[model samples]
Target: MPPIQLVVFDMAGTTVTDQHEVERCFTEAAAQTSLPVSPERILAVQGMGKRQVFQMLWAEQLGEQHPELERHVNTSYAAFRHILETHYQTQGASPTEGCLDTFAYLHKRGIAIALTTGFYRAVTDIILEKLGWLDGLNEQHVGTSDSLIQASVASDEVAEGRPAPLLIERAMHLLGVTDPKAVVNVGDTPSDLLSGQAAGVRLNLGVVNGTHSLDQLQPHPHDQLLASLAELPAVLEAL
Candidate 1:
């Protein structure tokens, strides 16, 4: 063991396979407030912050109809929150394939585990409750930094979201991490790969059990790629 301090995990795709419900909730909510026509467009904007995702989805639905789509976005996000509370948060979602054993191995070894997501407080709570791992989260270790300075987004965790390292940096700080290069970032999307890259972490493990396939994830190939988290231990041992 090299004394890995924190194993930072991505909330949605990394920890749980709830993208289907998550996407549907957003699309439905946005639609209720006059937006989107298809799930494919929303999927294309995957890995972005909720607000931007909503804006993009709504913009696509409107299709150059409104010069200012903020109002519709705002309404949709609100409705999205409601939908999440009812459907997504209530029903919950499944964890990524092999996530449990991998996490258990780390935690059992006294390695710290942290979850970072682009989701907001309320909706994320539903997810946490569903996973029953909310108790493991250290509120202080969470990151919602970029949105703090970028006020136009209307969310403290929406500014740069995943693709930026801000969230990872914030998580490391809260975890009392000293060496940035020692951390490991595991995610299911290219955005997460980009974020881990920005954090300067020496290891970034990408899994194909979520958003992208080998062909899509290859452009931003991770340090290691596997079918699922089950391959993580071997990857770590090799590291």
Candidate 2:
């Protein structure tokens, strides 16, 4: 087996601490904007880009060609951004259990680490800054080996979000990784696993400790399902 050169991780539920606050924020924003989307609907799209989530929802509710589709998408997305930004800013965020240890282990092994997120640039930066992970990244969100992480790719930066391979591909491009076989993709959602599989990565891993439970993720195609990020090092070692 080829050695893993990079590990692309999902933010929010995978690496960061999330207590369903994101879902609450989305629901509140939808209500405030009169989008009338259900909490179940919002939860279903957890790993997708925020704007695209609104776009999908509004298109479903108002019809793809509805005259007010764009307007509704814009209105609801703006509200969601505000609500999510405020929640993260005031309530703050932290690394999930074993997240830092995983980072350290990867660093010692010379495996590059990149963060891919459903969030746009602004909110992504806010969370990274709060965690002090933004220090070495340049304007493009790419950092050197000396930095905390090698790269940060926000969904807005790519042409598509989860379930699309662009985000993972972008991270590979930024990190000078040439083969999907040399990569490992880790996240807590089905879309995350789907994206990795689409990218043809070596491992498409899911962790159950986030927003999704084991039952929710079992049906999705993945190389393995972990209990949490804590088990990742052992898995990697045996690989």
Candidate 3:
């Protein structure tokens, strides 16, 4: 209602191209650590914090009271971080189709851009740096209106990740956006849409070209579902 002051986007699957490299890393780490979780299970928690996913899977497999649960979770998560960091560092990351164009469209209209992700701060920085999206942000990851993006919130920065409104709320805080109705949440996972719904954003959007398909996302609560970021400008205009 307030002209969409801020648009909070999920990084890996929404703005950035994932290519399932993240899932492959998770699978490799689980195998190496003997975590005993299936790829399907990992895929199911795609938009959750990486460490949280390990803890959940390990707890599911070993029972919450198991003495070795913490050890197993720690080992698996450490391995995941190492593998994921190396892969992103070596392979690099690119923006999703039309992501930059969408950003520019918002920029020209004086709307803020905030990128929230299930990734921890380190890997999030790596990916943003590679994409040149980190140019204007300070150490705290909050940038000015002149920056490419006005804010970024990593899962590590919050008490909880997707399916929780903390990341979106945190971004709103950083960007000085007060009304949920003035925000648009865009991501490529079910958790992404759920978080947006929880945050009470005006538009909770699911993009099909990322981690999940239309059928996969159809059951989730969202205001609209999009093919990709390419269609975002028109959607925003129609609002």
Candidate 4:
């Protein structure tokens, strides 16, 4: 097997500490917009793009051909963005347990690290800035050239988000990694696993420290399911 040249991580659940705040934000936004969405429904689509989530929920509630579907989606999504941004800005962001250690481990081995998120660029930036992960990022690509992480790909930067290969493929492109088999993709959601699988990454790992538990993610296709990112280095070493 080829050595892992790059490791792509998910932002909210995989590397960052998310206390279900994202789901809360989504639910609050839907209520603010007079859209009734169940908490279970919101959690089911955790890793999807914020706008796409709204679109899907609205489509389900009002039908795909509803004349006002686009308007409702736009309104709810805008509200979601505001709520989410304010939540991160005020509540602050923190790295998941052992996430920094994992980054250091990969850095010491000359492996490139990248972050991909279902968030748009603005909120993504706010969280990275809070975590001080943007210290050496390139303004042009909005990724690091010399920092521990090489790239940060937001859902807004790609043509599509999770469950689509675009985000992973874009991260690989930005990091100058050409071979999919030389990559490892890790996240905490089913969409993250699906994205990695679609990208043909060598390792499609699901970490249980974020949005989903081991049992929740067990139904998804992944090479391995980890208790947390702390176990990642060991798994990589074994592979």
The lDDT-based order of candidates, best leading, equals 2, 3, 4, 1
* Candidate 2 Cα misplacement greater than 4 A, ranges: none
Q: Candidate 2 or 4, higher TM-score?
A: 2
Tens digits of per-residue lDDT for model 1 on 72-158?
A: 878888887788778864576777878888877775555666677767767666766676655534453232221111111112453
Instruction: Quickly count the clashes in candidate 4.
Output: 0
Output the lDDT of residue 212, model 2.
95
Q: Write the per-residue lDDT of candidate 2 for residues 36-94, one digit (tens) a residue.
A: 88777888899999999999999998899999899999999999999999989998899
Top model number, lDDT: 2
Looking at model 3, report the run of 10 residues with the lowest lDDT sum. 35-44
Q: Enumerate residue pairs that collide in model 1.
A: none
Tens digits of per-residue lDDT for model 4, 1-239: 77899999999988999999999999899999999889888888998888989999999999999999999999999999999999999999999998999999998888899999999999999999999998788874445546867888898988888899999999888878899999999999999999999999999999998999989999999999998899999998897
TM-score between candidate 2 and the true structure = 0.99
Clashes of 3: 0
Runs in model 4 lying further than 4 Å from the true structure: 142-145
Cα-based RMSD of candidate 3? 0.7
Please state the error at residue 75 of candidate 3 in Å. 0.3
Per-candidate TM equals 0.82, 0.99, 0.98, 0.97
Identify the superior model by TM-score, candidate 3 or candidate 4.
3
Which 10 consecutive positions of candidate 1 have the poorest summed lDDT?
Answer: 146-155
Residue-by-residue lDDT tens digits, candidate 3, 128-192 = 99899999999889998899999999999999988899999999998788999999999999999
